[model samples]
Target: MYTEDLKVRFYETDALGHVNNTVIPAWFETGRLPVFELFTEQGNLYEVSLIVANLNVDFLRPVYFGEMVTLKTYIARIGKSSFDIGSEVWQSGQLCAKGTTILVNYDHKNGHSVPISEAIKAKLLQQTHPDHPLAS
Candidate 1:
């Protein structure tokens, strides 16, 4: 699993002083940059052949502003033309949220989904969690 740590900023909080629900998805997106780099030599996120096909976020607990959180990311599964990234947001040793994003490998220039490259597929297979629900 890969982990990135970040602190909740003042601006990310809502009127109740809790981190806003909308902010967590943005965190998930940013935390995947390193994973994206694994597929592209250009080092640019936009240059990758990926598009979000689906995203599900479950907010388990409220996080206060300035609280430190750890975002854990891992390949949950790799399908023919899509893959799932499982993520967790933990704060103060408690899991505050969990998320899964399904990304379709695509030929953007051709405007259609495409299979992941064999090299990328192998990397994802090696990195996928053994116990992940869909990994097998």
Candidate 2:
């Protein structure tokens, strides 16, 4: 699993004085940077060969500003041409939110999905979380 530490900014808070629901998705995206690197060449955006197919988020607790939070990301499942990423946000040892994002390997030039290479699959498997259902 990949972990990232973030400080909640005041501007991210809502009228309820906690982070807005929208912010969690952005945080989850940030946590996926490592995974993105696996599909790109030297962190080049032009080399990205994947596209987000779906995203889901569940808020469990309110996250407040000025506090540090940790975002954990892991490969939840791998398919022929797509994969699911599981992510979580924790604040003060509490799980604030959890999410899943599905990404499909694509051939941008051809405008179609393509099977993931075996080498890349091996790399992704290394990132699977032990607690995930699909983890060996």
Candidate 3:
């Protein structure tokens, strides 16, 4: 699993004083950076070969500005040409939000999904979270 530590900014808070619901998704994306690195060459964005297919987020509790949070990201499932990424946001030991995103390996030039290479699959499997529901 990959972990990212972040400080909640005041600008990310809502009128109600808690972090805006939209902010969690962005934080989750940041946590997925390591995964993105796996698909890129020499850290070049132009070499990325994946696209988001779906996303889901569940808010469990309020996250406040000025607090430190940890975003944990991990592989939930891997398929022939697609994979599911699971993420959790925690503040002061509480789970504030959880999310899942499905991404497909894509051939941008051909405009179609392509099978994930076995070498990449091995690397992804190494990062699967032990607490994941499917880990058993």
Best candidate according to lDDT: 2
Give residue 94's error in model 1 in angstroms: 0.8
lDDT string, candidate 1, 1-136, tens digits: 6789998899999999999999999999987787788778878777888889999999999988877999888899888889899988999999999999999988978899988888998877666655665564
Per-model C-alpha lDDT, please?
A: 0.86, 0.92, 0.91
Clashing residue pairs in candidate 3 are none
Off by over 4 Å in 2: none
Q: On a 0 to 100 scale, what is the lDDT of residue 62 in model 2?
A: 97
> How would you encode candidate 3's per-residue C-alpha lDDT over 1-136 as one tens digit per residue?
9988898899999887799998999998888888989997699867989899999999999998878999999999999999999999999999999999998999999999999999999999988998765432
Q: Per-residue alpha-carbon lDDT of model 2 for 61-94, expressed as tens digits?
A: 9999878999999999999999999999999999
After superposition, candidate 3 runs with Cα above 4 Å error: 133-136
Regions of model 1 farther than 4 Å from truth: 130-136
Candidate 1, residue 59: CA error in Å?
A: 0.7
lDDT of 3 at 82: 93
Clashes of 1: 0
Clashing pairs in 1: none
